[model samples]
Target: MSSTANTTYTTFTGWVDPPTDIRPPLTENFTCSVAVIGGGLAGMATALRLAERGVDTVLLESDFCGHGAGSRNAGQLASAPGGDIQLLNLLYRKGMPAIIRLTENAAGHVESMIEKLGIDCDYEAVGNVFAAVSRGQLGRTRRIAKILRRAGAHVEEGTARELGIPHGFLGGMREIKGGIMNPGKLLRGLRSAVLASTVRVFEQSKVVDIVRGNGGVTVETPGGVILAQKVVLATNAYAGEWDITPKRLSSPMWVTEVETEPISPQRLAALGWTSRSGLITQHNIMENYRLTARNTIVFGVRQIERAASYPLPERHPDPAVVADLAKAFARRFPPLADVAIDRTWGGWIGITSTWLPVAGTVGDDVYYSLACNGHGLAQATYVGTLIADRIATGITPDDLRTIWVDEPKFGHAVPMIMGRLGLRAAWTADRFNDMINGSKRHAREGFATAAGGFTAPA
Candidate 1:
């Protein structure tokens, strides 16, 4: 396929665009108490928090604020942790309580922000489901729920029907917190809040380099430079692009999502999706499905594309990958099989080898928080708030200290060639499992086999 066909697969996101109140880019030298680079959720939240405390802060974005992953995500306000909860419990066993606190607080913080700032982003606290597509996956979910609960998360285990989830999934765990929203609207609202603050905001001001001086840092942009006593690197996936940032801070991954044409309310009701809670499958690279305010279903992310190098270039969702997502959607919701996919878009997300969100300082003056995995919508905002508080008071909260690392020790590199092969293998395995234990068959089979033998459903 032509590069244009791939690049412009979906030019615009289906979400309603918020008002564009443009901010001018920096054209001359500027100075501030804290200079925040990148204007996504983390950066904006950090700047807003600092400015609220009367700190001289300047935020610079290559594009408009929230134009990156903040506005490009599935919009699920997840309270439970991302990645593998089981693995996290094993690796950070002692830090489980702190981790759980951070996850739960992240979700709560978003709701608080919405109420405080009066953001009308269609906020809902209906909670989210860790749905299973097969009998084996259902068993996995039960195990995961145990791990999460042990870590002090509020997780309820039940059958898909018992939990009010649609028919396509089997029994799984439901987090007591979290919901869905129009991320575009939420991000725009945050941008507005930040703009209202005393902080200086600039758009289209990409920082090309950073230099550490005697007592402060110098941020070099094309149009000008920013001299500040402290700097917050809220760039997330783009953090690796800067030489000053640790090379393995984040591995950039691209994920795609698609929205469907609005379905009839009656048809939506027929699917038994009454709760309207977002759903995520138990695959290695999970697929997410959620209900939109417009009566449409949005789903995507059966595959991910990893950037080969840093300073990531702008790209679009591949038409072939989007087609695969549509196919997955059809298999999961046969009733909506014929629904036309309205649009498809993708964005870069940061993923660390540890598969855990992290925050720390590179030095006395440079601070960073990144790799929230795919659950950044809430974590990013909360982490930013924590970082801002630490910068202002020089006192780190438990939450901030939990993820704070003095030096980044990255994992071994999974060669791109091997990574692609591993992804293919995983996709193939999921497909094979789907064929053997189809949703209908798994649902009919009732409860899966327990440690002893097949157990009856409750």
Candidate 2:
């Protein structure tokens, strides 16, 4: 809460403003070879690929493309999969290697795409770190590093000094494959490419219903109906808007991101963040911090708010949550404690039951990809391209086959349980651990009144 009352709350992301050149909504009935629903990163990539292959494709979006998590994410292209690697390994032992390979390759795909598209998104090849704030988290990092390395991921474990991170952290493992970038610019670049290509794009086109009859699927928006041979539903968090989507396909979680007022170069350099790698704390609900090219630092997501119903409403970051995040910022980057929070924003992102990125077919002509989890930056784009290729040529690539599900059935309502009460419990546990760690640190430092005075990072 450290005097973050001046922070500007925004419904959209703080990365970039809403695009001025919004494409007109569909106004007439149309037929096409393929129709892509939801113009986020995945849909745009899918339609773009289809158009490049000479397929008559139409991309339908409620808002402008990249308006969702595509532009709102922290922009860390992770080499390893999202969620706990140890859990993933224990659950899907044999699938771990393929998943690891896919994630690393996904990051490479983004790097290559950035170069090929000539995007000036302030991309830095400095890989991201799975940082540890306490001794328990440091041990967790070591164990996770071992799991990742056994699965063939390129990672390094070391102390904060060796990793070039801030001294506030004990140590962490660095994923050497992926890096950080200006996701807003990257999305704009992709949007430009899609608009320039032959793919017909319609903005502000809210789809009302989707009906499959005879040989084609009829996608109905408010203004018109589109009859296409195939349909690709790439809507991330809004997938629940359609009844056709699988039960428990994913959960929509609202996470916030806040940026600090610009800091001087000397102040930033004093933190010894030489590697300039984005840092993600190893908590149950992770907190991510990254330095922007604008000389400001952006961090968020210590707590998550899950949506109650579908058609997720547009909203700003909760003030209480933003305050909590600011307190966390002060602890993690004490050098920037006095820095004012410039603005705060929140976006809806989908997390699968398994905490894995998934792509599959609902029927014969309907295809879907959802829940890139938190690794949507690289994973979504790559999976979208794979889906496009699969539809373009009648063959599925091995990489695509790795995550492709034969049956679209999913487990019970796990996300609902993880929503409010579960989140509160997890937060309480983290805080309790932090208190214990703080007491130990104070005892070592010979502080007599450590019990009530110490507040540690967890």
Candidate 3:
């Protein structure tokens, strides 16, 4: 059967080129002990885990590795694993340790995978700076630093003035282990590692349907089919049309990133940003800034609502996103007021309502793994490994396995309808809330509700 669905998602920084290829379609009915769906980081990790166990498995991709959000993302290698403890404590109540391990290690796992497989994805561990753009954000960052310290993660206190910063910040939080990376190279390395294994990896073989028979499950694709006793679904934003879509806890959110032509090393030194570190302003609507290996200045923040207001223009990047990016860059880096923007790209990020990962067996033969809440670059891989391990060992504990699989208010058919609408309202409301000194809080909270959940604490 042929199906026509407006099911495509777009990204801003990543529409440039496709990843190196592997092989071709299945071209025949094949059977394995397990079948994994979606070829992004999560899917790749799941398949790699299964393969490591010497389990017979088949991995399916709608497009190619990293072709989706996997490859198109701004590669932020988070070292300290896990979510905000306060929010996790609220959502999980007494349940925290296991989920933290699964989500937080995702950041570390990125580095581990790169080292283990010798994949050169520009893995660096220079550290990340989380600063407050206002008094409210200052308090929040301080509290966040306390939480990380209590959790035993390495952290430090740094003031914007001491750090020689921009945007006129009061103070900041520092996480030294977090680093920068080339997202596409990371995904490419994983794909190469998976393909080199005995595990079967197939591309351009989009799954059309899934069936659970008396014996096992079967994943049907246009070119071929995969029959297995178990299956894993790792498609994040693109998995919306499936029965498992509701399993995601947060709503679909969009983000955009822009890269500038390399500023001379001398220019960077003069700007006080030559140090190997990334920075984020904890404003109402947060903004992140980083210096790339090539000395280019990159910045990312909330832009999904704006992108929805304007789809992928026939032109490379919608002028709105480009223009807004230019404005944001100038505001953050007044010294680089004359910098040239090389390119801009955007990608969709999945979030969960509970502000935690949602992973568990949907049916007996099928399992779900998704919603890292913009932390998928690491969390997804960590969650994917846990899911694969549990499935392999058949150890599905209620506390760990059953905690998040059912979190609510996630997945979107086309979020521009409501999500983008909420963003606009929040932007308007935030400006008004500023008079009462609650502008940042109100705006962040607004976007959280627009996302159908409370935004995770800073």
Best by TM-score: 2
Off by over 4 Å in 2: 413-417, 446-458
lDDT agreement with native, every candidate = 0.83, 0.88, 0.66
lDDT of 1 by residue, 224-257 (tens): 9989999999999998878888766667888998
Runs of candidate 3 exceeding 4 Å displacement:
1-16, 20-22, 79-103, 161-169, 306-317, 396-418, 428-458
lDDT of 3 by residue, 220-323 (tens): 88888778889988887656546544532445556677777778888787765534567766544556777776677667653454333212222233456566
Score residue 355 of candidate 2 by CA lDDT: 70
Give a tens-digit lDDT track for model 2, residues 1-458: 34586888888888998899999999999799999999888999899889999999999999899889999888888888998777788888888889888999999989998999898889999999999988889999999999899989999999888999877788899999888888988999999999999999999998888888867999999999999999999998898899888778788889999999999999999988889999998888899999899999988898988889977998998998999999988877777789989999989988876778889988879999888888989999999999999999989988899999879677653444466898888878877887787678667555535544544323
Clashing residue pairs, backbone N/CA/C < 3 A, model 2: none
RMSD of 2: 2.8
Off by over 4 Å in 1: 1-8, 413-418, 439-458
